[model samples]
Target: MLSARQRQLDRVRTFLFGSRTHYGAVFTVFLYALLIAIGFVYLYPLLFMFVTSIKSPEDLLNPMVQWVPTQIYTENYAKAYRVLNYPQTLTASVVMSVVPSALQVAVASLVGYGLARYRFPGKGLVLALVLATFIIPPQNTVIPQMLTYKQYGLLGSPLSLFLPAAFGQGFKSAIFILVFYQTFLTLPKVLEEAARLDGASDLRIFLTIALPAAVPAFIVLFVFSVVWYWNETFLTVIFLEGGVTTLPMQLSKFAQAYENLYPPGVVNIFDRLNEAIKMAGTFLNILPLLVMYFILQRWFVESIERTGIAGE
Candidate 1:
């Protein structure tokens, strides 16, 4: 009986402690606990924003209501939607983000492919320049670029954003170039050699062999570029200020817009803008990005895995 009892205890210990090949119950639980804590930390703000956005003015005033509201208030969303000019601003934001992203990716890919596949004079200097561009603050160049755009009569036009991206000088363009460079550098050279042996031109080799292998890298860069452009406000404000209005831009001026819509002295206190309404506007601003992320998350993850970005 003592020997049988000892064996049972040993089995229980092993199951809780794990073996060399498998994690134990305790470890699995601890790992999940840690993950949950980290997830909560990141998600806390979003949860607060959502909850606050749905809170009624009364709930905002109620000291007892912190997390849960007495009732769902959709009036905040309606007010925010109008203030943001949701339809028009959403369209502008999409165009600004997508167009620049496409142009940036196309330019960066070519530049990266050239850097990876060929030896050329001043190649090191070229790379150093690209790195320098990345390190340099955009604030330093904004004034000059703005002036140049004005001189060329391109200020407040999408071309102000497009031209730089088309030339591989978009926001964070250096990083995308490097990502592509690393991706193309890792490709098997034998395939390119075989293509060359078949009398394929350099362009043909790149198109058939290198391009296909780098699809994951392309997807990753485009997604990143889109997100960056979507969130960019400084350059957009300076360059596209007069011509276009994005969701973020509108959100920044939400207070002024709200005042215009409902004069504080004229409207009832209940109709005046409050924290709930501001939160609603903030939520609306990021809602499209959330939708985009959910839709592309699978592709984003697969591409990241294939590109091995984290490892690099």
Candidate 2:
């Protein structure tokens, strides 16, 4: 009897997942398949690059159907390291990555907490302005932003990036604010009131009561910081000028060097090792972000989802 009941429950689940009535389960499956196919299509080039990065010089150059390295040459990574100057790149990447993210989280959480907890005039207007910032094209602001930074004696300074974050601005501070605000707003007001009754000032409420209660949120922000700093190119390029270069820009410069050398589809001669080194360089560039995502991706998703739910 138990076996028969278990078999019936399994069949019901299978029917719900695999069968369609007016809902068009077939269409859902079709869309999923299409998305999977497209994803693989986009991934193939990167996959090819990774494979080529480990291939020997002659094997890398051959335009044949070789997918795996005929003879693996891991030394391409060493060559890439030397060419890119990893120590300088590491130093530059670290400063820009660590500071902005920490400050952004701090700013976002504080602003979000205020927006969630405080009732004030123009609060709606403030939220509106925050949303509007997302609509402005980043490219449009780059030139003017650079000029302003220059006038303020901030051009080519990492402080320019760090400072905006310290004050509660950067990429989509509005969205992050919204996210954290929505999350914080869901907390029981009694908690804040009780803390206030104990002689906790507003600052004490924020630092001691609220910020400490937001660990999951902090983990999400930390991960976002790691990824954004690793990938930030345009703003960094504009602000840093030649004063600093992050990993992305360095990799781009490497790509441009190859493009200029071979001119892509117009050239005949090139160093096979350099091409492999480019591949190696790209792998190194993304390695940290990949590791971070793999490690903290669960916490990041959980924090966002749980917060969103609490807000609702």
Give the top-scoring candidate (TM-score).
1
Per-residue lDDT tens digits of candidate 1, residues 71-155?
9999999999998999999999999999999999988889999999899999999999999999999899999999999999999
Q: Quote each prediction's TM-score.
A: 0.95, 0.81
Q: Give a tens-digit lDDT track for model 2, residues 81-178.
A: 76566788878888888888888888888888889999999999998988887788788778887899899889988887888888887756666777
Q: Judged by lDDT against the true structure, how good is candidate 2?
A: 0.77
TM-score of 2: 0.81
Model 2 clashes, total count: 0
Worst 10 residues of 2 by lDDT: 16-25
- lDDT accuracy of residue 40 in candidate 2: 92
